[model samples]
Target: MSDLSGIWVAIVTPFHNDATHSVDHAALRRLVQHLRQAEVTGLVALGSTGEAAALDDAEQDAVLDTVLDAAQGLPVIGGLAGNHVGHLHARLAHLNTLPLHAVLSPAPYYVRPSQAALVHHFQDLAERSHAPLVLYDIPYRTGVAMDLHTILTLAEHPHITGIKDCGGSLDKTQQLIADGRLQVLAGEDAQIFHNLCLGGAGAITAAAQTCPEGFMKMYGALREGQLKEARQWQHLLSPLIRALYAEPNPSVVKAVLANQGLVTTISRAPHLAASEEARRAATQVLDRVLREARHIGPESNR
Candidate 1:
């Protein structure tokens, strides 16, 4: 097992034409290659950005394979998400045979469980998982928040490694960092610098999917102690973030990648594609950020 101890991306799954859920292996390779050139530390495959929930198990496996192959040597994290312990267990079992660094699981959604139930779920998963576990605490989607208390307890499990916290609450993040039980990775692209301030390791950003050079520069600026520069970059990227998420996720992000000629302009149906208007908005934002780059990043990384 390897470490997921820095900025990583919950990659949007690139698709083959026909606008289906099938993996476009060549495009997937290019996306992963882009991350390498941009210097992201790792990748979370089949996560929400990848629309893992919408894919069947076989499709999810194919995506993971493509991700692992494209990753070269960087760590690959498989998203094995569900409300059912049985389904999660079966997924983990299938993954036990792979070379993934870890498996990420968000607790059951729609029906919010008590902290005790959440604890039990992680305990059961931690006990069986061959790789280390990453707790995903995106309450917006899961309708369940794995608070620091529950997470601190889970961290005691040998299999529990760290977290991908999208709850967007700094107080909860500080508590976990203060408690020293788990490492917290920033799940928001817009707040990478702020998270790094509170002992956060780095980001798992949506924007990084399309603008990795800009994203890695955010981290580089912070790491190199250029807080003023990092702050400027954060403020500059704010427009892009707003535009990218102005509509549904993956769609806008995938569309941005497609514009950059990195990925397909395709996504599963019922999931909307970015309209020309949305693309125009995002382009304007990216343009402003690029023009303002000298005020944001390290000269070398720039």
Candidate 2:
């Protein structure tokens, strides 16, 4: 199985500020390069933060392609989620052709399959997929929760190697870590430190996009048994994380990135831009975090 460990950022899909609102390939590349410089463990393309639900097949393909090319050898996990099995299989077939590290899939949204059905669904996808499968268990968005038993059973599959855990159950999280089978990644940004301290692999974090260096420093500190250092970084990053999710995801994230001149603050229909309040909050927190990170000096980060 692939070592699905460390900070993997679920990147946002940058769109042009135009009437068409087309994918901004150049800006996307820039964002990828920026993350790369921070030395993140990997990149998750088209995950929820990427606004995958809003993009069509062609647009998804284009976005994935852009991410792969600009990733420049960073392991990339393509996001896959849908209710239609046949369509999902077809999408998996295409993903198989690409050089993806893994495919991040969730329980079928809206359909809310039974636990048994969830197992079968993931088993089938794992069998069909060329790359390993990282189960994305976000009950809130998918409207269906995977019981702990369900996840443990799925772990029996060779291709089912890890989980992006947003189930909101600390007990389940601890059990998964203790099981010593699947690699557990904290799906929620706020839980990153908690998850890591419990022996989770790392995080598939959207918040890291705004401050990868701090996230990396936290991870590094924890790994090196520097609890105090890690805690300091976590404290610095918490407010920004909360602010990024103060509105719907990727809005404040885009707003912050826009301030950095990496991407525009434009979202598709039904998803509005971040409020000025959210923008101001994120900006303030981000500035303080960056300022403190600098004050601590590069030696501490290392």
Candidate 3:
């Protein structure tokens, strides 16, 4: 089984600043190398943070290829979501051709399938997928929530190895951790520390991409039973995390990355660029977090 524990960054897709706003493979590779240097446990490509919905299939495949090549040996998880069963299966078949550690999928969005149907959907997918499956339970975006029982049922499937918990229920989160069938990764950035404290595997967080060294330090301190140190890192990182989400996801995240010259601040069409105010706020918070991270010692340095 893939080790789904520790900090896995849901990396953003970098775009060129030109009119076409093409996928910046060079910048994306550089970002991957940077994250690898920061010691993130792994990478989740084509996740929501990656603006996967905006990219065509060819674009998505190209982006995944870039990520896979640049990831070196880091275990990379690819995101898959949609209501179309045939298309999903086809995508899974294509993904099976890659060396992904796992494929992260969610409940069929907008369809709001019955819990039993949800179970069937995942089970079917798991059976067809060569790679292990990590369930993505972000109800708000998916328009449907998977109950604890539903998740437990899916966990019984051998190929369903983990879950990205964004169900927004502390009870559900705790129970999943207690059940111990599937590795539980906190999908919500603010819940990473709390989830870890509750015996969760770790987090699949977009925020980690911004200040990965600080996140690595936080995870490292927690792993070594340094709760107090972990708490300090959490406090330092909270503001920046909030700021990154102050605008729609990857926009502010890209803004911050652009500020560091890693990528352009452009998001795909239908998603606006981060406002100057949001960019300034995120950059300010990021700067402060980096400054404080320096004091936490060399472990926080990339």
Candidate 4:
């Protein structure tokens, strides 16, 4: 497959304060530059954490364009979701025109199609998408799970190269790893250490956006077989990871980013800005992470 290992960030979509609440292209560009400086493996634009659901087509296109431009050669993956096959096919075609590395698509939400049908859904996507496909298996969000059999069957396809595994089932994760077909990326921040330790690939994590250097350091320690160092980093990261999810996802993530002036604390409707308490807790953890980064050195992969 495409070696989808290492820490890939699920970038947040920054919005402006105008009446239209349009996307803040400038901030988005700045965030991209920030991540690039942090040495993240890749970028996933318009993913769930990026508020893809709230953005219109034009805004999403603009956001993708900004990220692509600012990435400066980082492999940027576009997040594709929805139940409409025809529209999705059209969307995939649209994505083909861009220079994306891949598309991270999840199962049809709420519809909960059968396994056989699910197989055909991704099969069609894989066939239509010029870029590689990374199946997003977040059962809680999608309301459906691709059982081990279904995942293995899909893994047989050449275009279906990897998976963003948020199923939260260790057994299923282990099975996919043992099968040796799809490159398994841990989608859950809390499970990143465990996943990497289990011979799984890297992560497509929202939490990594806050402290990309720290996550990369943890990954490097694991790859170098420095279990003790890896554990220490994970221990320090656990609180931040937990705090970021204390209120939904990117809300806390945005708040933390805003503290560093990387992005605003604004979030879209239905997802309120993180409360002061949550932001404070996350900021506290972020401070600790920064302190460690300074003391231990920021040389990830060393």
- Taking every candidate in turn, the Cα RMSD to the unseen true structure, in Å, is 2.2, 1.6, 2.3, 2.1
- In order, what lDDT does every prediction score? 0.81, 0.94, 0.92, 0.91
Top TM-score hit = 2
Comparing 1 with 2 on TM-score, the higher-scoring candidate is: 2
- Clashes per model (N, Cα, C within 3 A): 0, 0, 0, 0
lDDT of 4 by residue, 210-298 (tens): 99989999999899898877888998899899999999989999999999898888888878899999999999989988887654533
Error of 2 at 186 (Å): 0.2
Where in model 2 is the C-alpha error above 4 Å?
A: 297-302
Q: How high is the lDDT of residue 296 in model 3?
A: 74
Query: In lDDT terms, which candidate is top?
Result: 2
How do the candidates rank by TM-score, highest first?
A: 2, 3, 4, 1
The sequence of per-residue lDDT tens digits that candidate 1 reaches over residues 93-132 is 9999899888888888888999999999888988888888
Q: Lowest lDDT 10-mer window, candidate 4? A: 293-302
The TM-scores of all predictions, comma-separated, are 0.93, 0.98, 0.97, 0.97
Give the number of colliding residue pairs in candidate 4.
Answer: 0
lDDT of residue 261 for candidate 2:
96
Q: Give the distance in Å from residue 29's predicted Cα in candidate 2 to where it truly belongs.
A: 0.5
Clashing pairs in 4: none
lDDT of 2 by residue, 1-302 (tens): 89988999999999998998899999999999999999999999998899998999999999989999999999999999999999999999999999999999999999889999999999999999999999999999999999999999999999999999999999999999999899999999999999999999999999999999999989998998888788888888998899899999989999999999999999887799999999999999999999888755336646
